[model samples]
Target: MSGTFVGMPAFPEAARGAVHNATLRANLRHATTTIRRKRAVAVAELSDWAELREAGKQIKDHTLRHLDRYLEQLEDAVTAAGGTVHWAADADEANRIVTGLVKATGETEVVKVKSMATQEIGLNEALEAAGIRAYETDLAELIVQLGDDRPSHILVPAIHRNRGEIRDIFRAEMTRWGRPAPDDLTDTPAELAEAARLHLREKFLRTKVGISGANFMVAETGTLVVVESEGNGRMCLTLPETLISVVGIEKTVPTWRDLEVFLQTLPRSSTAERMNPYTSMWTGTTDGDGPRAFHLVLLDNGRTDTLADAVGRQALRCIRCSACLNVCPVYERAGGHAYGSVYPGPIGAILSPQLRGTDSDIDASLPYASTLCGACYEVCPVAIDIPEVLVHLRERVAQGGQVTRAGTKVVLKPARGHAAERAAMRATRWALTHPGAVRAGQRLAARTRRFHPSRLPGPGKAWTATRDLPAVPPESFGDWWKRTNGGTRDERGGSR
Candidate 1:
């Protein structure tokens, strides 16, 4: 949830821990593969899924293009409909706004619907600083909270933890928060669920305020939508007197018709169902029906900065279904925690660097996490071309070691102790740009192919020490091709 990715290791360093954990790998494989297959089946059922996907993409793009206009419309509508709209420019601003909102409501505790926006802003940590207790109502989120763990997957936050591990977290940590874990708490799905249910039910009914993040907010109707599999969303949306929704600016769609596209694609892509069990929506506030007072905090938090980028702005189109995560080979082996952001896996690889910038070793490392296999692109409901973006970002990172912000580029210096890579890359780029020097060097290497060393020397010697250099042929490929097949002779022969 931290804005800065300082102290987080690069992907290779973080992934090493995940790859070594056999249980994590097994859990990732089983869960992702199952979800991938189910999602494929659900998607195949809809004949117009592609159009829906495109519409969703276009809707997000259009809204983003005229974001200032749509956002003002949203603010006007919400205010007219008896809701207050607060704008947050960054994580710190968002957190301060949320903390102030809670303090204004005179509530020390808030029951929360599963909200990724809050996670990105670290609202809970911020609230804790102000002595306001925030409770997660969604079941997986409850598991994450009670377990004192960070969310791994977006849809299923506790996907990394098996039942056994969950049982341990609940047994170990739940009591200190509010209700005690049942003495008979077991790893059995139903029992674990029951333990969480009892624990959350109390917080729901007792809390005076609720906090949430919406999947989509409709500008025309001043509506906020929350889609989920559990009944927790219903509790958070209805049970409290004052409901405060903290949502990202990018989550806005122009109208209800636009909302419907994601309603179809999101449920199928994320949970592998025809529809989520709960799709709770509200327009401002309804007296006696739900929360009597409502507030919508529209958070920018680096989004506007990201949207200014031509190639990077496409990341804003994500609906966070995380289908790409399931199909990602790197995510399967390395797991989600390695990404070090609330959003993880394929979406995280592109989205995180944009939202957080590639300043840190972790964000810089994320662009290189993929094999660029394009499996993520195949599964993405919005067709986010994640591999394309990853490579674009990798170029952004490796070339100047920096990311651009608002038409300006910022170069990043190598972290302490990684200077050798920067130097190596600089030399490589220099060698590549000068063709005459490269050709002469190549010819000499070919002439002395047998005498050429198998390993690099100097600062690079350590890199090739363990791995053998590729064998160079006696003749360069260009020379061999010229000697063996004259271009004109081959054309005359008409081999094709």
Candidate 2:
């Protein structure tokens, strides 16, 4: 996990603050609602959406099943295409590799396309710590960088900020990083975009290095694909003398044909476009076109651990389209920062715990951040079944188990505060197994119903604080069943 999110509070604690921010909630609701509606329409245009989704699922599953072989093939293909491939087992190693590469270029600054991989590894912060500057060129990313804020969405990093907030960030922060925004910048979309464009153009022309993360990597031809609405990715991909892409190993597909399914699904799922405005594909470096030196850093960062879980591994099938986020009720209210990871929303709820493990407060609480309404699964292009994974992870967190961390298997203690829950589940199992005991307990509860408190005490206080405890029936259901011959029972314990 990136050091940037170290010491983040648990989800409930973080969400409490975000949930109160009326402006942030409004921004998120408006943006996500619009995206969701547009996405639904775009998806309806596809006649074979189900087939495309299934194909994508199968492709990812097959590639993951034989990841070792496919990754080697991908490495060979990349090397054959006059590019170098570096394997990073974790975030620190990945950052070190990238920093070394940038330092080797003898350049202090690099322009970046919006790359979740880079953000996940805290590459910008790493580069800055090493005395090198990394400029984000994507409009949303530029806004995020200028505001000194974390990305709140996968596609739109600045989705939490409205136009006015963006204008303020641009006017106040742009000069600190690079070229200043116009003296009188307004909140209009066109003006904000132009200000970002003019600010980035100088970096595009002068910077010798560029960094990015790929949407997909083709093993058969060593092709990397980046789908974006902004031309910033194309500019970053082409204008630099040295191009370095840090990508997750899970992003690789077996062939270009497999890439086709995602190309269709990703844009529609993400931007609600038939296709993104700019879809950039390149095979290493060309003689006189694009960067002369190209490098691909394949980052594992606990993806291998994620792949080892049966039910949870399906999370790797995510294409980062963020359809799940747009439709997520939790994300709409609590916003992205609550997840406490580079990945946010429903996908983050499942993906972050697996990637980072459940040892930390934030990671342990992530599984419970959702309503489990299955909206995320419904919208997922690859049918990731996010709710299922979330529940599975919850189980993992509730019960101590062996988990892989940094390629080493270690036993984890059950998360704190689950002792009461575990005891209750045990009591439930015992009662269910003994019919006589359940009947006796039911009768006792019924007889003692009048003494019951509306609010519980001790560990159960939190549960009852916001909810009314159900009143126990005057008689047991079993007693009523015996009296009524299973026909019906009235509220007064009379047979009907």
Candidate 3:
């Protein structure tokens, strides 16, 4: 729900442009294909992957079921460990709390680890508006920041950009932020990484405040974990004098023992590695070790509303592995930008609508963005039934049902442009209930089959534009059955 994505075009309209970009398609295809193959191999090496996935799902379900208790326990543990806890009920509150925390430190600039929660709240924009400059230290995040672009992927935010484009961004925009790129920076991976490293190092050493979002928070110990392939997370978590983390309340697990399940599944599912190269875990603050001041902002931002739905609550179990993105046929082609949220791909389709309510054009269109392939569910570490949620959300959008917005229950008007669909569904239900009417309708359709237009007019044109209307046969199936048999068959034996 960041302002960055506000007023975005609906998915179909946005995807129409993305689908035409050959270079973007090439970049996404190569990245997703490579990751997909490697993930398969990495997952196959584990003998009890199904067990691990189920265990992960059960743990999240149990923790979410008792979320209030775990959150209180986590807050107490954090306070006891010398860290302060702040509860944020929505995006505006979270941003205000983080901005206020940074202002309290008297620092004008803060270094950031890659954080989806921060992105969700649009923290950088909020900080910038308050005269605080926030620098993104993650390699991919750096690319996005330098280009003044929004992230298109979750794990690898700059997945849409190739090497050459990255080099261009650094060369053109790096100096305005901090360190400038090398004059002769090449398009090689090593060179690009080195350019980002040198550029971020100065900011890392000088910045007095650091901000992050955690992969998981241990309620029993008040420890937060961030897993990454690069060591930038370590630097951000340790180097700054003041550290503030904005985490969704749903990211908390009951104990360190429950954290074990995700530590195994996340690395393999995300980067296709047995273990990530860097995993940083910190509890409160340590003397003469890391940041002397620690603040944790717990963000609720519609998560409580999402948890209120039994069928939709499973989305809270996601570990941000992004396995579902790689396997999603829709994501592969439409790309992440089309989803119009910090979260993209299959997860975004279901998650965004719930978090933001399907009242907006972009949020309303997201549930219809997928093809319902179920590939996302097959690869999900916590087995979130994404297709099931998509359909459920579709019903919510079509029928206009009771939903929670900002913690209050409200009924939404059915989304615009669905009147015909709603009427058709009602007609279908009626015909199915009345066999005689269905028989009559079928015979009428068969008789007037040739008179049917090849293309429809008005509202129906949109549906028929890309699809062919199936031609009706000369006779209905029921009529053919009766003619062949000459009479109804007796239930106990043969035709009479």
Cα lDDT of all candidates, in order?
A: 0.85, 0.92, 0.92
lDDT (10s digit) by residue, model 1, range 1-496: 2133348898889889999999999889999989989999999999999898888778888998998888888888888888989988788988888898889989899988888998988888889889998888777887778767778888888888888988998898888888988998889999988898888888888898989999998888788899987788899889888888999999888887887788889999988999988889888888678988898989988888788678888999898898989989999999988998888998999988898887788988888899999999988888888888898887777655544564467665545544677787787899899977877888998888878787888877987977989987776766656655745445345543
- In terms of TM-score, how similar is model 1 to the real structure? 0.91
The digit string of per-residue lDDT tens for model 3 on 351-396 reads: 9999988878899999999999899999999999999999999999
Reference-based lDDT, residue 454, model 2: 96
Better of 1 and 2 by lDDT: 2
- Put down candidate 2 lDDT per residue, 231-292, tens digits, no spaces: 99999999999999999999999998887799999999999999999999999889999999
In model 1, the worst 10-residue window by lDDT is 487-496
Better of 1 and 3 by lDDT: 3
The number of the candidate with the highest TM-score is: 2
**Global CA lDDT computed for model 2:** 0.92
Would you estimate the TM-scores of all the predictions?
0.91, 0.96, 0.96
Clash pairs, candidate 2, are: none
